[model samples]
Target: PQLGGPIWADPIHDIEFVQKVLSAVSTNPSRFGTSKRIEGMLSMMTEELPDVPLYYALDHLCSTVHCNTPAMLQFRSALLHAGYRVSMSHASRNGLKTDAPPGVIWDLLRCWEKANPVKRERLSETSPAFRILSTEPTLQACFDVREDANPQSRKRHLVRFQENPQANWGPKARAKDSGGISSELEDKRKLCQNKRKNQVTDASQLKNFPCKRFRKGTCTHGDKCCYSHESASDEADKME
Candidate 1:
């Protein structure tokens, strides 16, 4: 019935259409473009496909209470001790994803408070911390660092979290009618640029800082490492 080219009589679903496009591009590579061009097209199209759901579900645990790195480590250790799988969530730096129940998590927090001892005057009677801490822990939560508490991502030194490429790098207000950034924002950007570079000019300024990994005997970077591998007493002696 169609004259100029092929025409579709029936409607195709979104997923089905995507699959059809993928199949057509893959089968007729020469018709598209050069090898590199076709490869790029395929890659871009492939990214549009829906991601497969994870086999095991993870419960996101965003803590209301302030927790430093050591506190977070202690929490992870406690969770591991309680026979629950735990890992740092990409959603938040301080947040953790765990399979542990709400009760278990609350019990662990109570145990941490008992071990660290928060000042009674600081916590209000109506506060969640006070309400949670008042109840005795149902499970025995240990704060001791377990071997498995440190995740593989940290051990591997993978680039999991990205540092800001430049100061004031996030979303900005729409450009002015003049098609340029505001004067205030531009001035702030200029001031922040090379801020870190200017802070430490001399190489010696970085030295004598004790490497935590080296102290723990887990540092893979040997003598070439910039951080000092010497003990605290040795560093003190060096200072003298």
Candidate 2:
């Protein structure tokens, strides 16, 4: 099916960007880092660009399949509308060499996927295509959405989430900062500490002497003790 609507712009800009990228890589320029100029060019493609990076996998590293597959682009674009990070992989072509290079000939496609969520949402809403390229919610977060917006259960059922939901992927800083203690409990602890620091008690002035050692069951002096084991109850009563 012809998935895209009529093209409005001429192919001139496309040709210009492609030639510029090709020229940049060809000159062996000093600005290129790690002899990986192609990666730099790939990174720059997202600069004010309408494209989403889709990395389809070859089970065999050195396969004959062309890198720029048009069908993959359309399929991925459709999936992008549904809020997904889509990549196609050949299952049967696993006969390649084991000592392959790490990472991409370009930056990892998923990293590029998260680059522009606004453009992605716009692409998603454009054609209303149902051809699913992928279903995985590559980005969503309880942390990303407002707490009232969607519950954690509903988060998984939907693709789109709050803007920049990556913060949900990490440990919650607010919970850690508060040490998971509630404000009431923390206040009670502070109150107890303040009582210990600010209130001085004299055993001689007390009507009922409470023995600290009795609480731990370490008191050897029973009836002869000036502090009474029963005084704990009296102290509790006084406080109440």
Candidate 3:
């Protein structure tokens, strides 16, 4: 069943919680919900995903300099539109070894430098083409330029490395920062983990057991117990 509730602010963590709940239901069917009709429930739930993450940002790792720089430039422009500043660098292929040496940015830069010597000079000028670019969302702008102010229509591929403004620690920092998640998926993961931990082991599996939570129909922790059946019943009634 689609159990609707208040939307969690942190969907990533909520998805984990839901997963844990489902896992608990699946493994401990007798203790939690009955297993007789669970398969259909799971199938339906999987088929009709109401919410999901669309565009997740991740650090694009360039392992070598052999690859082209134009692709990276295009990526930078796209990210810029989507609100991300990026460091620009080009790679050279003439002197590049079949295998680029590990642990260096210059290796990539040198390759591009060889390919586009003119671009390198432009980058080095007082007004460098490669820059730390950012467009502020200022409500009251100090200056506004006409659409045809420059009188020169520029091509998109012109700007290469426009470093990300928020990334202070460079590639390492950016890589560490980016993350992705959907709330529903995360909730479900948590439900699964809890189920696994509390699962009845083979040694005790064959034994005819009483309700796991209430030791002789009485929970030791009373209201604080996570597995307290009385509390669960109250919760179910409240939900209904």
Q: How many residue pairs clash in all the candidates, one count each? A: 0, 1, 36
Instruction: Please list the C-alpha lDDT of all candidates, in the order they appear.
Output: 0.61, 0.36, 0.34
Query: Candidate 2 on 91-143: residue-level lDDT in tens?
Result: 21111111112232112222223332223343443332211212233433111
lDDT of 3 by residue, 48-123 (tens): 2124211112122221222234343333333333332232212211111111122222323333334433333334
Q: What TM-score does model 3 achieve against the real structure?
A: 0.15
Q: Provide TM-scores for the models.
A: 0.42, 0.18, 0.15
Cα deviation in Å at residue 28, candidate 1? Answer: 25
C-alpha lDDT of residue 36 in model 3: 29
CA error at residue 77 for candidate 2, angstroms: 9.7
Which is the better candidate, 1 or 2, if ranked by lDDT? Answer: 1
lDDT by residue (92-144, candidate 1, tens digit) is: 45656566777887777666667667676787889765677789999888879
RMSD of 1: 20.3
List runs of model 2 lying over 4 Å from the truth.
1-15, 27-31, 34-40, 43-240
Output the number of the TM-score-best candidate. Answer: 1
Candidate 2 lDDT at 43 equals 33
Among residues 3 or more apart in sequence or in different chains, the pairs in candidate 2 whose N, CA or C atoms overlap within 3 Å are 81-124
Best by lDDT: 1
Task: Give candidate 3's whole-model lDDT.
Answer: 0.34
What C-alpha lDDT, on a 0 to 100 scale, does residue 69 get in candidate 1?
23
